[model samples]
Target: MSDMTMTAAVEAALPKAPFEGRHLIDGIWRGSDNGESFDRTSPSHGILVSRSARAGRAETEAAIGAARKAFDDGRWSRISGKERATLLLKVADLIEANVERMALLETLESGKPISQARGEISGAADLWRYAASLARTMHGDSHNSLGEDMLAMVLKEPIGVVSIITPWNFPFWILSQKLPFALAAGCTCVIKPSEMTPSTTVILGELLLQAGLPVGVVNIVLGFGQPVGALMAEHPDVDMVSFTGSTAVGKAIAAAASVTLKKVALELGGKNPQVVFPDADLESAADAITFGVYFNAGECCNSGSRIIVHEDIADTLVEKVVALSKKVAFGDPLNPETQVGAIISQAHQEKIAGYVKDALAAGARVKLGGAPVSHPGLPGRFFAPTVVTGVTADMAIAREEVFGPVLSVLTFRTLEEAIALTNDAAYGLSAGVWSENVHTCLAFARRAEAGTVWTNTWMDGFPEVAFGGYKQSGQGRENGHYGLEEFLEIKSVVMRVGRTRSNWVRA
Candidate 1:
């Protein structure tokens, strides 16, 4: 179906003005106490999409206070696992029902292609369903080996008041990754979504309430990262802080939360590498590498921006990559045919372009598309799908996380050199190795320092697997049972059946 038909059908299915510019606290929509708000504009066309309330310190405190109350009062945290599971299932159903509207809002606010947005929305519903299943299976432990004299058991208790701060890119998808697990763990939360893309997340607040989540079970406070995010990180009442952003910001949040010693789960930046071996299928490797670096405009934390290839296959691989990248469509995000949409903002576009410009000045050869693409009358932030050859490990473009649609190609003479080059970077979130030989690929996968390693694949996985980083990439896992564990605290219980001990102090 056409893009217009899809959008028209979605509009017809939902009510107008679903997203309101207000904070969702205590199960109600309200304005910021400071009377501050901000306008969210479409990065695709620089048009205002919605005016969301910019919550400050007071609002942040209020949200935190409400979450704490809900948890301590047993309004949410003390609920049965089956009950929480039921609520989460309802949330998943609601999300599936409203996929069109959520996808449209995400595209309008974040400037991603409508098709990609729709996929992310559907994926979010899947995540919610998966987490709901986990909620029912959140089991503790019991040991009968203690015999009749004593009994021992381990209980998993909820870590109260989680503060979630999600990024602008993939706003709803990332939020779904963290929030559902937190809720499944029976933790009440206060969410601080990115100011650049707050509309869809705010709309989710309504869905949560409609799903029958109790008041203050999940609150969303929208604002800049400074006062809102910083305050949430440092708040003493908050038991844990879960953040998905840059390593620098993660460090700051970790340091600030250290004051209260709150549990922190960080999913940070990455300089992922995709290694193509001489024996690999060149065409498939090229296609996978193109998708690795160009998907979501390369705004992904695990984006394989570093392309390390065998010297023998370098020429043929680069040729195929250049050809495929040229065909990547860049245009209005609402258009279904546009594979590559606008950058998150103008400033980000400049940052991405600056990396390419620096590489060119450093004597790097541009295999194809080293400049930004301007679409007349669109006024959206768009960069060309870039592929640079002759990139040295010492260059900033190869070392730093550019977070753009730019791929740096570096050739390796041997398997040892390929592994060394991939591990040389400070960040190790993910890596991809392509080879027909099973032993060679398995060895490469075992040696790669990244948390996730894909053989003959770039970025492919199910939500059941654990995903996170090693070195500077991140601190904790984000999917499966590991994600649920991030928000749980272990407690041990013991009971003596046969003996009553006399106190030594009495003697």
Candidate 2:
């Protein structure tokens, strides 16, 4: 009676692998100190997929020690940027060669559509290429003028050993975002991917090895947030730490890194807003807005979950949005027709669902969907795309990052109010404004609290444009020269011909 395609079943029923995650120390893969491991399941089908290392403090120490040795030994950082770029490009080629496999793994782990995963995988490959291209361009500074006989210059160098912790939503995307830039700046790394999704990172390690990178230059350690992640954060050997996850975790990592004065770059969570003006194209806005939040099942950092619409057009836009939301077919991630896929897991589904229920309790209206779908004989944790109308600034759905297919709608009387409403949250990753007025667009773009403000778009990313957040959204930008700068530190060397110390005051 079901019309499910064979591709769907093949994807949903792929045989799982083993507990294969290992600590990549000294250019080799080794198990955790105690061989401890944990299993991760496919959220789309509720089946076991792989077991990763449950790394503890001991394994963590080995990774840190290895990184220290690599930095001290001058194997990677001492190398030229062109050589590093070559190796990085080699890695990119390997990734491009095996993108399909990586895409499938990502889809299995995150329950995102296979097509979307394919695009993400492809995008990651491009990211590596982009990093490679920028590698040769990372330059320091040259200055002279101390007493006319002195010459001074500055050198931008690696921040020493780095620890990059990525998230489940985008294992490869975030890892590539951090790794290439660090390597381009001549720093080695110890990567700890999300325990929920480690397969792609594991394979990435393999590709790096094939790319002929120096031993101990890059290490992959699998672990959760407690001992392994905590140890890596506070580890003295790790001079810098980069994380892409929740704001809560970013704060903790930042605090831990503070003890050692380590450089930390965080791409944390967001509760971004999308504003729609009365004079704007409601249809285009509706389409963009719908896809903006509902894409990736609304699990993006800049989901535009909060929509501030002009009160005059609020009613029409709501209906357009509702109708548009209903047409996004959801069933199988493999099918290109499926616009929405499964939630990450039952717990996550319930978490997003809980927000919807709480919104209803707070007198919000469910304009489209607010519950999970029922598929007989299939135990997938799938939540229908949900839209919450009549949302207030104080509501939980508006304040917190639901991180699901849930959108909270609000009304604004004018552009100033809209800007105020959008900036009311602690996040400032990205925002969108739909208006034809150039002044209005410029005003909102300048005033929006977020770092990236789109005049008439959402979720659009490029390798050249700079992106990051302010306030609680996170620290430091990713993409472009700004992104490369995040992985580097500037050190000035002052030269003086007349070396005697001279002061206005005599001792």
Best-matching candidate per lDDT: 1
**Model 1 steric clash pairs:** none
For candidate 2, the clash count comes to 0
Clash totals for all models, in order? 0, 0
Give the Cα lDDT of each candidate: 0.87, 0.84
What is the per-residue lDDT of model 1 for residues 1-507, given as tens digits with 9 covering 90 to 100? 111111111222222443566899888899988687888777876667778888888888989999999999988788888999899889988988898888888887888989999998888888888888898899899888986677888999999999999999989989999999999999999998888889888888999988888998899898998899999999999999999999999999999999999999999999999998888988889899989898999998988898999888888898898878777776778777777788898888889989989998998988777767666647677777788999999999999999999999999998899999999988989999999999989999999999999999878867798889999998999888998999999999988876665577974
Q: Deviation in angstroms for 340 in model 2?
A: 1.8
Alpha-carbon shift of residue 130 in model 1 (angstroms): 0.7
Which parts of model 1 are misplaced by more than 4 Å? 1-19, 500-507
Q: Residue 319 of model 2: what lDDT?
A: 86
What lDDT tens digits, residue by residue, belong to model 2 across residues 1-507?
Answer: 121211233334465554366768778788777778988887776768777777888877887888888888889889887998899899988988998888877887888888888888778988888898888888888786565767788989888899999999988888888899888888888989999889999999989998998888888889898887888899888999899999999999999999999889999999988899988888899999888888888888978788999999998998888777777766566666666677887778889988999989999999777887754434677777677899999999999999987889999997789989999998999999999888898899999999899988778888888889999999898889998998888899888767565787988
**Alpha-carbon RMSD of each model:** 3.5, 2.8
| Candidate 2 local Cα displacement, residue 214, angstroms | 0.5
